[model samples]
Target: MSQLVIQDLHVSIGDKPVVKSVSLTIKQGEVHAVMGPNGTGKSTLAKAIAGHPDYTITQGDVLLDGRSLLAMEPDERARAGLFLAFQYPSEIPGVSIANFIRAALQARLGESAELDATGYYKKLYEKMDLLKIDRKFTSRSVNDGFSGGEKKRCEILQLAMLDPKFALMDETDSGLDIDALRVVADGVNKLRTGQLGILLITHYQRLLNYIVPDFVHVMHEGHIVRSGDKSLALELEAKGYAWLKKELVHA
Candidate 1:
């Protein structure tokens, strides 16, 4: 099994410190939820690990399968099996979903290696069916004028097609209604059975209710403060971040 180790990571954006000394390890086939209120640096952690240019890793390291990710470019990090599902997926006009995903898969292959077109379509249809997406969706432009639900489901479709070793999903539930959230969560749940460790980031427990995590971590003021099982998420939903703040003060 592969592992993604984030060792005492400290991130800064334009010299403003965001994530501080955060450490965690995600092994394949596990879902770890990192939950906290907005502006707590949850997204920063994911962006930093994904090699986003705006965020700098001032301290520590992120390793994929025991290799440091700090030196790799965002695209290189992606090819190395680190997938970062964005909170807001970008809209690409004139690119069909089928072509876009096919291009990504093609990039992963060596120059001399040819992608088997028939096999690719076969697998794509299988995954789309598993997610309950309409086969006709293949012809739509990527997230161009899509509803919130459609955009998120498209992100999941990309995830399924890419099949990375580990994924960092930042606020995937943002702007989603109950029905859309359920559909997106269902897509994620279906993909959890392989070498696909996921670090699911969200601010609310409602998302967790649909997609139960093996571990739940709480981030506060740029660092991880608490971690436990799915029950911790329920506690957070009940008492809220203010209560956790007070408890931290007492502790």
Candidate 2:
């Protein structure tokens, strides 16, 4: 089974440490929510794991199915089945969404192998239909001039097409209206299965109401201070982070 194991991870931006010895394990088919206030290093952890150069891993190891990912480059890590859905997806002007995803998939193929264009479009259309994205969207530039909801939905579309074993989704619901949030949630829900593991990072419990994670982790000051099932999310939602801060101080 595929699993993502982060052990004693310490990450930094330049010389300033952001993640302090945070560790977690996510198994295939599980949805693990990482909740924390801004600057608590939730996004930092996800970016570090995805091999973002800005966040340096000062100490620790990230492993995927027993293989150490710390040594791999960002592209290498991606090809190894690790995917990060950004909080702010970049705008790639002049590049069609279909071409962008096609390039990514092509990069993963063997040198002598070729992607069947007809087959590729067939699969892309199926995934687009499933996500409720218009078939005409394939020709649009990636995230260019897209609405906040449309951008988020575009990321989900990429996720669906890539079929990564493990996905780190960072604040996917940000800037989305209720309708857009539901659409994105539906796309994510449809992709959930025993073969994929997802680490969902968000601040709001409202998203949890839709995605329904298997586990919830509360992070504070770069460490996971609390963990529980879905109820924990509700508790945190009602009580807010103040109680969690107090508990951490008392502990």
Candidate 3:
């Protein structure tokens, strides 16, 4: 089983400690939600796990299965089946969506093998169709001049094509309308399987309503303060963060 284990993780950006001893475990077929208020270092935690250079891991370890991911480079981490769908996907001016995804898939293949272009396109088209993406979108530049919903959908499309063991999705519902959010949630629900684990990071409970998580963790001041089933999300939504703050203070 593919599993991601983060143990007592401490991350910093320069001298500022952003993630303070945050630990969580996600196994295949489980959907884990990390919800918190802004500036709580939620995004920092995701970037640290993805091996982003700006954030430094000062202590603790991140493991994929039994292997230590801390020792691996960013590219190596990706090739090892870890994927991060960014909250704000970058725009690739010159690269077509098809070419970019193809390059990523090719990188996974060793030098001895080459991807069959015909088969690759067929598969890409199939996934695109499943996501309700237009056939013409394959030739468009990645996230260039696309709407907010389109960018989020593109992220989901990449996840479907790459088929990673673990996915770190940060604020996927950001900037999306109700209809768009539903579409994205449908894609995510369809992609969930026994071989895939997802870490969904978001600040809102609306997304959780659509893509009901198996575990919901409330992060306060960089650590998980509470964890429960999907009901926790609804409670947070109704009561707001102030109630959580009060509970933490009283605890």
Candidate 2 lDDT, tens digit per residue, 21-116? 998999999999999899999999999999998989999999999999998999999999988999999999999999999999999996788988
What ranking emerges by lDDT with the best candidate at the front? 1, 2, 3
TM-scores for candidates 1 onward, in order? 0.98, 0.99, 0.98
lDDT on C-alpha atoms for all candidate structures: 0.95, 0.94, 0.93
Task: TM-score for candidate 1, please give it.
Answer: 0.98
Q: Assess candidate 3 and give its TM-score to the true structure.
A: 0.98
Model 1, span 40-115: residue lDDT tens = 9999999999999999899999988889999999999999999999999999999999999999999999688888
Minimal lDDT window, size 10, model 3: 187-196
The residue pairs that clash in candidate 3, if any, are none
**Model 2 CA deviation exceeding 4 Å by range:** none
Regions of candidate 1 where Cα sits further than 4 Å from its true position: none
Q: After superposition, how far is residue 41 of candidate 2 from its true place, in Å?
A: 0.3
Model 2 TM-score on a 0 to 1 scale: 0.99
What lDDT score is found at residue 154 in candidate 2? Answer: 87
| Per-residue lDDT over 1-251 for candidate 3, one digit per residue giving the tens place of the 0 to 100 score | 77999999999999999889988999999999999999898899999999999999999999999899998899899999899999999999989999999999999997889998999999999998888889998799999999999999999999999999999999999999999999999999989867889999999999999999999999988888999999999999999999999999999
